[model samples]
Target: MKKLILVRHAKTEQLYDYSKSDFDRKLLPRGHKDAATIANQLKNKEIIPDLFITSKAKRAKQTAEIYAETLGYNPSAIKKEQFIYDGYTTSEMIKYLSQFNSGSDTIIIFGHNPDIAGFTVNLISDDLWHFPTSCTTVINFNIDSWKDIEVRSGKVELYIYPKMFK
Candidate 1:
């Protein structure tokens, strides 16, 4: 089985940063956070992903860094994939991933939403899902090879959203 954790980046700035290009917008302070402090979500989960990949966008990168640090993963080992920031539909992203990183049993990807949320919904069910900032969903695929994964075949192991914290 393959495990995938998808995270939509934390709240950002610059109308939440609409004027800012999607690639460079940074995280907005959540009250006293004053920075990206979203580590707690991954703490007790013991999430040590075999491969940690993130969009090159500033916000996504920052969120990935926080999760990596919290999980004791080597920050530098995290890969920055520009294509993620560029944007791709659910199937395109899945094909891209299957082509390159099939060796990993567990993979974590940090990226933006509507796309991220859309992919998760396609994986677990046909129902629509709203993926908020800092949202993290853990999905377990029954296939041994990522290339064999099918839509609606993924089982959602856990789904965490920032609202649950505050």
Candidate 2:
């Protein structure tokens, strides 16, 4: 079986600066708190990740770092995948997972919304319309290999977010 944890980056600053790219935007103070909140929840649940993958975007990386710190994971080990940049699609995410077939049984991926939410829906039909900031969803696939993961081939094992606690 393969377990995948998908996380949406925490709330980022909605900056109006035209000179800055969206990829460079940093997380807000609330984003840090919320990331820690959800990470702690996963820690309490004893969810240990075999690998940590994250988007190269600034906010996503920051959120992943916060979660790593809270969960006692090595922040330096978190992979900043460049292909998972801001405009990635659901199919791209599926293809990305296929590359990790042998090594990691359980993986945690941190990324942006619409993309991550769409990836979750394409995997399990979870009807996730609004994947809020700092949200984490666990999907369990019956298949032994990540390459065998087809559309709706997984089950939602857990769904959590910071607001769910508040």
lDDT of 1 by residue, 1-166 (tens): 8888888888887545466576777777761142134456556666558888999988888888788877788989999998887778878878977865456988989987777888888889635477778878889988878788777888888887777766
What is the C-alpha local distance difference test score of candidate 2? 0.88
lDDT of each: 0.78, 0.88
Tell me the TM-score of model 1: 0.86
Error of 1 at 146 (Å): 1.4
What overall lDDT, based on C-alpha atoms, would model 1 receive against the true structure? 0.78
Record all residue pairs in model 2 with backbone atoms less than 3 Å apart, i.e. clashing: none
Clash pairs for candidate 1 = 14-17
User: Which residue segments of model 2 deviate by more than 4 Å?
Assistant: none
Top of the candidates by lDDT: 2
List CA RMSD, all candidates: 2.7, 1.3
